[model samples]
Target: MTFTDILREENDDVFQKIFSHPFVQGIGKGDVPKEALAHYIKADYEYLNAFMHIYGAAISKSGSREDIQYFNNQIDFVLNSEIHPHNNFCKHIGASYEELQGYPLPPTADHYVKHMMYHAHMGGLGEITGALLPCPWTYLEIGKELVKLYKPTVNHPFYHWITFYANEQVEETTLQMRKRLDDLASKASEKELEQMKIAFRKSCQLELAFWEMAYTCEEWPVRDYVKV
Candidate 1:
């Protein structure tokens, strides 16, 4: 099976569990608490900011000159145009470009970021591509369900914000990752290629767990804006 197919099948299992949860199901349906939603909004922005930085680092370290340029251009656009602007959910949550500088990301967030950097710094280009694909790709999968279940409305900034990353950006990134993977896989050692597949799958599971933790928690300082 193709990398995209493998990722989709693995993500489907995790997305179902997250979407089936009461907290996730309630979002955008008027059941979520405003405070919880607010927290999520802020956290999501912080997360995105960190994500851009980490991915930028990976792009910088890529072996392929083209990969480096692609990631750099994408990162520049996201930081300057897409994410920097104080509009939409970022505006509603008071997450300005300046505030993003001081935002404190979750520890687990660092794990993913650092992991990508490590692979990019030490591993082949294909390995770095594999490492980066799971998170955005999984988010895209979940975002589709959220859109389906909780049609976007003015009141639901949280869902709307996430949908942007999941729909528009993730597809483009996934396509780039597939191209990188295919190109590198030919030169990659058999063991290294297998490891990349395993790492991608494990990362997908972690993404699911992160959502499950957010939904199952009783009190989240960051997600308090959304009422459970």
Candidate 2:
């Protein structure tokens, strides 16, 4: 099977566990803790900023003009739609852009962001896609859990909020990424393909770490500011 196939297969178990977690269930039922909700939103905003910065660099490095254009278009859409709208959402959640920007991120957040940049810099599109798979893919998997766990009267704003990310948005992004990866793999050299495999594994492992950190409320250097 191709690397994409392998990734989908490997992620199956992780996705199930994420959706089943009590925290995720709370989201489905619309009953998340206020603090947890705030943290999730803030962290996601910060991470998106970091992601776009790194993706911009990756697009610059793409060898093919077509790939470069694609990356640029994707980045543009994210900024105009995702990031901009998220900022507005934060306001609705009683948060300000300044506050979200000032809040500290966990160490895992930094590690995850850096990993994406590294892959983009060294691995081209296939490697970059491999590295990125964990983000949306993880959300998509966890979303399934939400669907299973959802309740009608939970009254949890955060639950619905998370659903937006993990379910609809994440699924859309994953499908687009899968297409991109297929395109890249078909054209990539054998060496590049091998690198993509390694990147995929590493990214998956990082994803596991990302969830563990989030679930356990682990604090790192960045956590100094954003206590869980």
Candidate 3:
């Protein structure tokens, strides 16, 4: 089996929890609250912005012209398609870019972005790929399953989000990343492989936390939330 397959097998339990999480299930059912979704969209925009930074790091770390082009193309896609559309969606739902920009990063979001940036900046190309692959990969996988489970209604608040992930372009991005990762795995030592697995697993866990945070509208604890 490829390293991607192995990693999936090893982390199956984590993915299961993520798939079963009420936040994700709500997407399939269209039962998630608008307030919860607004929180999620704001937070997800942060995640994608961090992803663009990671792509820049990947572009620098790539050894080959093809690899550099791959990251560059992904950078374009995220900026033009993923992030802009997201910002528009947020606006459509009453969350302006200015408002979202001013919002403090929740603890869950802060941790996830730091983990991704740390690996992209500090690790090799392989490690960077391992760290960043889960975002596109997870969404594509989840999107496909949701498509099968339910045909999205035209007015479904999450239809745009659903279709974006389920579309071929996102899956193509994941495939390219997986190809690069498998090539790296071929030359990696067992210890290095273990480290990749750890990074991959941590990303999956963070994704679950991200969804849970949105589902619960979790906010950073401060004087506002704490009893004096």
Candidate 4:
């Protein structure tokens, strides 16, 4: 089996939790509290900003024009394509995507982005891809699964969000990233491959935590203790 297949099999439990999370299920039923959706929109907007930076880091670490262009295209997709769903959801929730940009990254999101940044700064392309792969890939999995389970109609509150991630474009990008990682793994030393595995697993854990964070609207504990 391919390395990604291995990772997926191992991380199936976590992915299952993510799929069953209230936040995701709410999206399916179109009944999630607007506040929860607002929290997710704000936090995810910040998270995607950091996500794009990792792509930039990957471009810097790339040794080939092909790799650079791939990251560039992903950056464009994030900016132009991926966020359209966010914008649409924002309109429905009566929030401005532009205003959400200034909201602080929630604690879980901060930790998640730092995890990716650590790998991006300290490792090569393989490590960067390893850390980066979970975001899009897992969302694609969730999107596809949601569609299969819920059969969300066009009138579903998050129909665009669900369909956006489940679409061919997302699957294509995910497969391309997987192909890139598999290519990198083909030449990697065992030690390097193990590090990539570690990165992949940890990122999967973080992805699950991200859904929990959205469901809870997680905030810093310090904020509770230290009143302004």
Task: Output the number of the TM-score-best candidate.
Answer: 4
TM-score, structure 2 vs. true: 0.76
TM-score, ranked from best to worst: 4, 3, 2, 1
Query: Each prediction's Cα lDDT score?
Result: 0.60, 0.66, 0.81, 0.88
Report per-prediction Cα RMSD to one decimal: 5.9, 4.2, 3.3, 2.1
Instruction: Tell me the spans in candidate 4 whose CA falls farther than 4 Å from its real position.
Output: 224-228
| Candidate 2: Cα lDDT at 114 | 81
- Model 1 CA lDDT for position 173: 66
Q: How far is candidate 4 from the true structure (C-alpha RMSD, Å)?
A: 2.1
Candidate 3 lands at a TM-score of: 0.90
Query: Candidate 1, residue 30: CA error in Å?
Result: 5.1
List the candidate 2 regions with Cα displacement exceeding 4 Å. Answer: 83-94, 151-156, 159-163, 166-170, 215-217, 221-228
Q: Higher lDDT: candidate 1 or 4?
A: 4
Q: Which candidate number would show the highest lDDT if scored against the true structure?
A: 4
Deviation in Å, model 1, residue 58 alpha carbon: 2.9
- Could you tell which candidate, 2 or 3, scores higher by TM-score? 3
TM-score of each: 0.70, 0.76, 0.90, 0.95
The model with the greater TM-score, 2 or 4, is: 4
The alpha-carbon lDDT assigned to residue 147 of candidate 2 equals 55
Q: Model 2: how far is 50 from its true place, Å?
A: 1.6
